[model samples]
Target: RHPGWPARLGPLLVPVGRVALRPPRLLDGGAWSHVRTRDRAHLERWEPTSTVDWADRNTVLAWPGQWGALRGMARRGQALPFVITVDDELAGQVTIGNIVRGALRSAWIGYWVAGDRVRGGVASVAVALATDHAFNVAGLHRLEATVRPENAPSLRVLQKLGFREEGLFRRYLDVDGAWRDHLCFAITTEDAPEGLVARLIGSGRAQRP
Candidate 1:
């Protein structure tokens, strides 16, 4: 049987310059919605086709429940859903999902930055933090991320964090309404010392928050 979910999760904080990562909150709905609404086109170009009806008011109202489910997942140690904040403003989100413990000890990572934050190193910082949390705090042996071959920005993020290219998966995921090929990238605990965050900061790719 799976572990029972807890009522709450302990605070998980990661700071980088004016950027910080924390669990999602209900109060973030408006800001989250705004970012998504504004960046829908920008995001869809590289993201999977989301079934969630972004234009529906009902869907907007369901933010709390959606966030609640993420918290539940975190409590059960199955996932970590975090929001990236820059100077107290919501910039993006990163999630480590499909966590498998036992022998595999791995998970898949995904993320998106608000259109305004793109190319500004927000995704890089967020990825670094997520990678650190996955290998250090979560105690996972490995973390993987898949990106479309044309997604230069995301590919750069993975490369900066030392995720090696594993191979291409043909029709790996349904993205932007089509089954698309993806380039797999992965990093294991043995890949870096002091975690990816320290490496990023030390390399001057990101500033310490």
Candidate 2:
């Protein structure tokens, strides 16, 4: 584990309005499974194809192993995996992965909200909170995200949070099977001196559930 990992990055709850981000708990399996199954079709287009059936009973039963692996990564300071909550109910997830220290203090952010929760600023608030934590608490200098051109909603989320378009990566990731091109977006601590969540709220764009 990294120094002060527990004290600095241990289980945390960041809340704003009706939205919150917290570590995924093993006990959340049933709720998480329910939401994922409900949003499978809504999410599959943007996500990589999975061999494991989300609706399968065994998948939900595997929560302990999955959660344990993620927890291990968190302990090693390699990732921050959080479940998005609305009014204390599980809504989706936001993850900060590929953490690199040394001279390059950076990571990548990814998130998904329940289909019913889309376009309601739930993703924006969850992402903004994650970004703030990545920059301020995680001590990361830069955060990046990638989105398919057709993913207008995701692009809007990045735009609203002020992520600058860096460039395009041809066939960057395998989504739903085939390699897909993605536009890279990034933000740095210097880019938001006032902090992302604060700026978002001040812009009168922060919507509560």
Candidate 3:
């Protein structure tokens, strides 16, 4: 385990208005699987290709193992995997991964929202909360995110949170099936002296519920 790990293994709650983030739970498998299955077409375009059939019962049965793996990583301080909630209901996920301490003190941020929940600022608020935790609570210096060039909504989420465009990476990640070009966006602790969530709220891009 990393020496800098949070004092407690988390269900760490970061809430603002109706949006909240919490660690993923073992029992959430069914709901999580359902959302992914239902949003297959909606999400696959931006997601890495997966061979598993999300709608299959076997896939749902595998949730515990997946959750366990993430939990282990969290325990080791390698990642922060959080499920986004709205009005206490599952809405999406915001994950802080690839943490590198010491000289770098950086991590990667990634997220997705349920199809029906899109355009409501759920992604923005969830990400802001996660970024705040990564910087303030988890003691990271910088956070980075990548988006496919065509993912306008996701690009907007990063932009609204004040992440600066770093550059573009060709064939950066495999999406759906083919390798796709991606734009890199990053934010450092110095970028938001007041906190990312506060910056987001002040910009009028996110509102209190």
Q: What lDDT score goes with residue 76 in model 1?
A: 74
Query: What would the TM-score be for candidate 3 when compared with the true structure?
Result: 0.89
Segments in model 1 whose C-alpha atoms lie over 4 Å from true places = 1-17, 51-53, 57-59
Task: Please give, for residues 1-209, the per-residue lDDT of candidate 3 as tens digits.
Answer: 55444332222232333777787888888788888888878887887767865466335787898789888998989998888877677778888888889999998999999887788778888888888878877889999999998999999989888999999999989887898999999999999989877777777766555
Predictions in order: lDDT: 0.77, 0.80, 0.80
Record all residue pairs in model 3 with backbone atoms less than 3 Å apart, i.e. clashing: none
lDDT-wise, the better of 1 and 2 is 2
Per-candidate TM-score against the hidden true structure: 0.87, 0.89, 0.89
Ranking by lDDT: 2, 3, 1
Per-residue lDDT over 63-93 for candidate 2, one digit per residue giving the tens place of the 0 to 100 score? 7887888789889899888888876888888
Name model 3 segments beyond 4 Å from true: 1-17, 207-209
TM-score of 2: 0.89
